[model samples]
Target: MCSRIEDVITEKARTALLQVLGPLPWLEKAQGEVRPTDQIQLIRPYKGGHELALARWGFVSAGMGTAALKKYAMFNARGETLSESRAFGPAFRTQRCVVPLSAFYEWPTVDGKKRKTRMSRPDGLPLLVAGLWNRCEGSEGTVESCTLVTRPPTSDLLSVHDRMPALLLSKDLETWLHGTPEEAQTAALTSWRTGVLQMQAV
Candidate 1:
């Protein structure tokens, strides 16, 4: 599981987003290593195009009480079960978004010692990870949160980790952001099957 990642919305990453997605709205900063529950930059579908928004890292289930929900970690949702999960199913069909990352960290056992590895694309582009978001109202008020989508690692990454974040390619961005549910699913599956990222020991 991808439990930790580099700061998602670095200036460099913002520049990359601008180049691809074009003139994203300026969002407040939440710098440093990002963990679950932190406010992070998310590029979600907006009135036909995309917009930058800040959302908490974990997906909050509206049906579950606060006590029960606290025990469950909803930071990463399994791609295989997207359509079946109560917290993710509805979000997957409509509230999909992209989690941009400068890099993600993985802890892999190498020999007798576990090593920290940094995962990123070979071409130095930002990693646009597919994700789902939801809005839940509670006694405190309303909260918007998101969860990264994960799938079985590709052949090359199996040795490094069992699962990796589902990524979106440049071509599939439009389909994923605005296409029908079926088309979005197809785009997601294609991304999981074909996306490539490189890992390096930090």
Candidate 2:
């Protein structure tokens, strides 16, 4: 499972997202590696187009105490069991989102030790990854959070990791965001092809 991701919401990425999903006038620009519990930008389905919202990287359910967050990890949700998972099933059905990235990092063993690897598209466009979001109301305030969806790794990246983030192509973004439950399930299960990314030791 991936616990870290590289920079997202760059200027280039924002442009790419706007080009495909149409104008998101309120989308803010940001850049940096993201980790669990970090606040990040999420593209959500809204008003027949897309809208930009801010959400913490990890999924937080209603009434889930702070201490519980430390006990469980909800940053990445497995695609295969999404429908069966209490933490992910509801969001998977109605709260699908896109997590855009300039690149993502993975640690793979090289020689005698594990080395950091950066994986990105050859054309330098943003990679739109599938995700599920939720809103939890607590005493402090309302917290919105999200979790990335992952599937079995492609052959090209199997040596790097056993699972990879589920990516959404431009054509399928709508289906993922607003399709019926069944159609959305199909979109979630579709993994991007291999060779679309180039990995480098970093």
lDDT string for model 1 (43-162, tens) is 886776678888889888785567866898899998888888776889988899988887888889999789999888776678888888888897788888899988888777888888
Which residue ranges in model 1 land beyond 4 Å of their true spot? 8-12, 28-30, 192-196
Local distance difference test, each candidate: 0.80, 0.84
Q: Which ten residues in a row have the lowest lDDT in candidate 2?
A: 23-32
Q: Superposing all C-alpha atoms, what RMSD in Å does each candidate have to the true structure?
A: 2.1, 1.6
TM-score result, candidate 2: 0.93
Q: How displaced is residue 34 in candidate 1, in Å?
A: 0.9
Q: What is the per-residue lDDT of model 2 for residues 180-199, given as tens digits with 9 covering 90 to 100?
A: 86787678677477779999
TM-score of 1: 0.89
Stretch of 10 with least lDDT, candidate 1:
188-197
